[model samples]
Target: MESPGRLPYRRLMIYLDRLGYLLGLEGVALLRAFREDGSDRAFVEARIAEIRRLLDTPALAEAGGVTAEPGAVSMAEVYAAWAPHYDAGGNQMIDSEQPVVRSILDGLPVGVALDAACGTGRHTAYLAELGHQVIGIDRSPDMLAHARARLPGASLLEADLHRLPLPDDAVDTVVCALALVHVPDLARALAEFARVLRPGGHLVISDPHLLSAYLAPRKERTSADGRPALVADHHRPLSDYLAAALPLGFQVRRCAEPRRPALPLVAGTRPPESLPPHGAWDIMYWCPEAANAAMENTPVAVVWHFQLS
Candidate 1:
């Protein structure tokens, strides 16, 4: 049972999380205050200052901790070089998928969480901040390099998603963020995650929606040095994903086809016809004729949350 103010604090947190998104960096201090136990005003204020300081400062990563070994092929090589800049770059996935995933995760039990295919620890860091014991795994050493720096206390492993190193029924939650598209056969990965989750453990997955895949040029990406790399992107329709998982004794709790966020228009770029003229305009169309046409028909990403029966 919670105390007098605890229930109110918890309820306030739900509203505040959404508030944080709309407010950005400025909301951090206010949100930080709510994380306190009523008794600790000084501790909360100090932590807020620390967060503000860390947000502005550049990390001084040591040589060994930051280096990513180059891969033999273009598929691997692209991610290897891009690993350092992956978190720093303008990523639509983080902006679009994360908020939806984070909101779903809010209602789930916080315990041991497996960050399957955790690239650069985006979800890993969030799960930790939510008070979960996080174990982050990825095949890319380059991405793992950044993840290691981001989460020093959490266990970060370099491993294939098809064969997770953890024991069966080990984790309480499994979070696979935007990585399922790369695996052609999700059976192996899904089976492995099921094997590792205790009964009733929750699984949260986010991927580029199959509908958008056919409509957009999102699967392939070029590296920093102009080397073209095309990663394998399997189109698993919603029916296919649900079909595969239901047989594993999992029941769907929630699902979302989250729309792409309306980003601030680039300077000198004309606003799209869809965007209403405003004091501060937001637009989704990079190339209004092409991008907007595809975006209008389908969601940016597919997300799911399920609990094992």
Candidate 2:
């Protein structure tokens, strides 16, 4: 057997690994909990309690468990259930795009651009104002409807990002803001992004960091009438995001962590009937600008951008 003095160190290392694993499962479980009933306060509280317990256990120091908390749901289910509310007041999350757009325009050559997951056209209209032909693509018709109304002149297409309708190397810039987290297969989505970008074109992407997923730092909430509300998810790490950009022939131009608003910018211009009593707020945006700029000089941010090889 190992010496008693070394036992604590060995146990501590085991505990740390277990804690990491538990946290990862908790991330997935949290996604499920929100989906089952976004407004289910009891359910969410129970999950929080369970996750806390797991984090506190002594054995967790030796080996972590990756079990889902009771009554957890999937991320896709959560998005689909929240789709209507998302379209109505969800633009608040996209408001983080203001800074992202500013960063991209400051560096990229103005031309045709695509808002890969345009949501409600928050960035679509802004890109148009920048004098670039903008095309917004989303999988939800309701989302596209709101996007179209907001950006009537800009082209809005209802399609999934994994399988885009655009030809390879057709656009000057591609902006994927806050959409990668929901994608089941992040690698596939990044491939699609590479496939559509023109040689030497620019691509900007933003998403929550994996570490942020565990340190939520806020109390979970529910509707007064008890409806499930959605929170953010970070399916992949910063390293994965960077790796996806390479091998597709795109060079890392700028990698910076862009800041986001404290609360999600609520969409005020939606039909009242489809709106939620309280909007989903507090989504983060990452603004990574990659160009064929030879990877030598790139503007980088703290919270949002990550430079790729």
Instruction: Pick the lDDT winner.
Output: 1
For model 1, the run of ten residues with the poorest summed lDDT: 60-69
* Deviation of model 2 at 179, angstroms: 0.6
In model 2, state the lDDT of residue 70: 14
List model 1 lDDT by residue over 22-77, tens digit each: 12322333443465334256644544564464344333111111111122124456
Every candidate's CA RMSD: 19.2, 15.2
The clash tally of candidate 1 reads: 0
In model 1, the runs with Cα more than 4 Å from the true position are 1-74, 218-229, 261-287
Write model 2 residue lDDT over 1-309, tens digit each, in one string: 245656421132211233454354455545655654543666556556756865675654444322222113344444455665664544423444457656756666788888998877766777887888888998867677777777776788878888999998788778887778767577788788777777666777766545434433222233234433333333566677667666666576655554333332222222222212221112111100100111111112222332222
